[model samples]
Target: MITIQDIRNAQENIQDTINATPILQSGQLSQLCRNQVFFKCEHLQKTGSFKIRGATNKVKQVVMEGAKLVTAASSGNHGQAVSFIAQQLGVPATIVVPTDVNPCKMNAIDAYDGNIVKCGTTSAERIPRAIEIAAEQNGLFIPPYDDPYIMAGQGTTGLEILEQVQDVDAVIVPIGGGGLISGILTAIKETNPNIKVYGVEPETANDTFLSFQNGRITSITPTSTIADGLRATQPGDMTFPVMQKYLDDLVLVTDEEIRRAFSVVMERMKQIIEPSSAVTVAALMNKKLPLEGKKVVTVISGGNVDLARISELMIGTERIY
Candidate 1:
């Protein structure tokens, strides 16, 4: 298990390459949630997502140890992060992506000079393929979620939240493979155990919630949702235990709620976040858990959506204009 010290080390490792994204508050959302709410704007991070933190941390160390090639399997965001960092370090990156990967993400990877290989869709299919490619090419495998260095790096977000927020009473984070929330949970619980950490997942991607309910790790074939980043079929062995130990609760939000939250943020906050980031906002807006009158921070995971889908995502929600 990783400790606060490990996260601190990751922070030091990533500081030069990673962006310490800003923390901003929306008065509209604060009033709606009845809490002093702040958004950890990781969407504005390098690679347009928080994945760069872990990718940089992992890649930096491996490169120091003489690694020449890096490989990862990702739907989109993780691939972008890995490609971006490897390009910076002059290390070759091979990202095995799903066949139906978002073209915008693929373009971003290509711009970073990542060697792209199309594999089967879904994590279950692509993960092993990426690992095989890494072994075949004598490359270092940078996992998307289930690695100690990666989780420690992601925990840096919680450390930043603690430093940035004045009186943070709780934090709401969106969970996929449990990497982000697990790291946040460790960073919070180890330092300030009183601060509640809640994990939110799309109802279709409720593996962590089900794991908590069943008293062990569990698997579920996630149904499709607009919150693509939260679609992991199961929590990781490493990440799940941290979540089980330190997470205060788990919440599930529907795709409809995600779309509404996406619209609200787009129209009112004027922030173009992806639907995955909107999952945390949806949980807060729908009052999935009692957080009334508390100082809360919601992690906006990323904002890397195709522009063409903005109008489609905003459907069913009223706009001021």
Candidate 2:
């Protein structure tokens, strides 16, 4: 079980390593949602995500234990994060990514000088390959989530939110593999028990939401969605239990809703955020969560959208309206 102590230890380990991303008030989103909306801009972090916090901590831990090579699987952000951190620490890194993973993320891994092993097209298939590589090469497997260190690294985001916002009523976070929310929930629940922590998922990819409801890990066949980051098929065993204990509720938003929120972040806040990162904002704007007049913080998880996709979404939204 991941205790708050794990997050505290991670905080100590990664204090000087990762950026303490800003928590800024979004006037436009506040007006639209009828709530005081604060955006925890993890998109601005090193490697363009909060993943760096966990990746840094996990890599350091692995390195300290004399692991020369580290292996993991990701579509992009986690891979970039791990690869980049491992390079900084002078450790060999291999990222097992889906052969069809997004070009932007693959470029990010390459930019960090990570060895890319093209695997099958889904995380479910990619995970075994990572494990296999880890076994063959005697490397440590730093999963995107499902590890205590990673969850603690993600919990650092919640720590920043609590320190930045006073008397926050709720925190809305996007859920994929569940590491981010698990960390946030653990931190928030321990620090301020009264604040509600909600997990948001794209309707096209609601594995965590379904898993929470079903009382076990449930798989979903990921459909076409703009939020590529939220396309994980199932939640990890470790993260699901943490979420079950700490999260207040789970909400779902459509792909269109996610795209609109992505556009709004670009236009109003002048910040670039990926569709997966926009799910929390999308939920708030669509009246899916009852947050009127309350102080709510939404974690914008990443900003790594492909330029072509953003153009298509912008033009498509204009045509529809």
The numbered model that scores best in TM-score is 1
Tens digit per residue, CA lDDT, model 1, 1-321: 889999999999899998889998888888877888899999999999999998998999899999989999998899999999999999999999888777888889999999999987677777899999989999989999999999999999999999999779999999988778888898989999999999899998888888989999888873678887777888999999999888888989998889888888887789999899999889888989888999999999999998888888985544321
Best-fitting candidate, scored by lDDT: 1
How close is each model in CA RMSD to the real structure?
1.4, 1.5
Q: Over 4 Å off in model 1, which ranges? A: 316-321
Q: What residue pairs clash in candidate 1, if any at all? A: none
- lDDT string for model 2 (1-321, tens) is 677788889999998889989887877679988999999999999999889999988899989989999998998999999999899988889999987788888999999999999987778888899999999999989999889889999998998899999999999999999999999999999988999999998887889888878999999985667788777899999999998888899999998887788777777778888888989988998999877999999999998878766776652436322
What TM-score against the true fold does each predicted structure earn? 0.97, 0.96
Worst 10 residues of 1 by lDDT: 312-321
Question: lDDT for model 1, on a 0 to 1 scale?
Answer: 0.89
Error of 1 at 39 (Å): 0.2
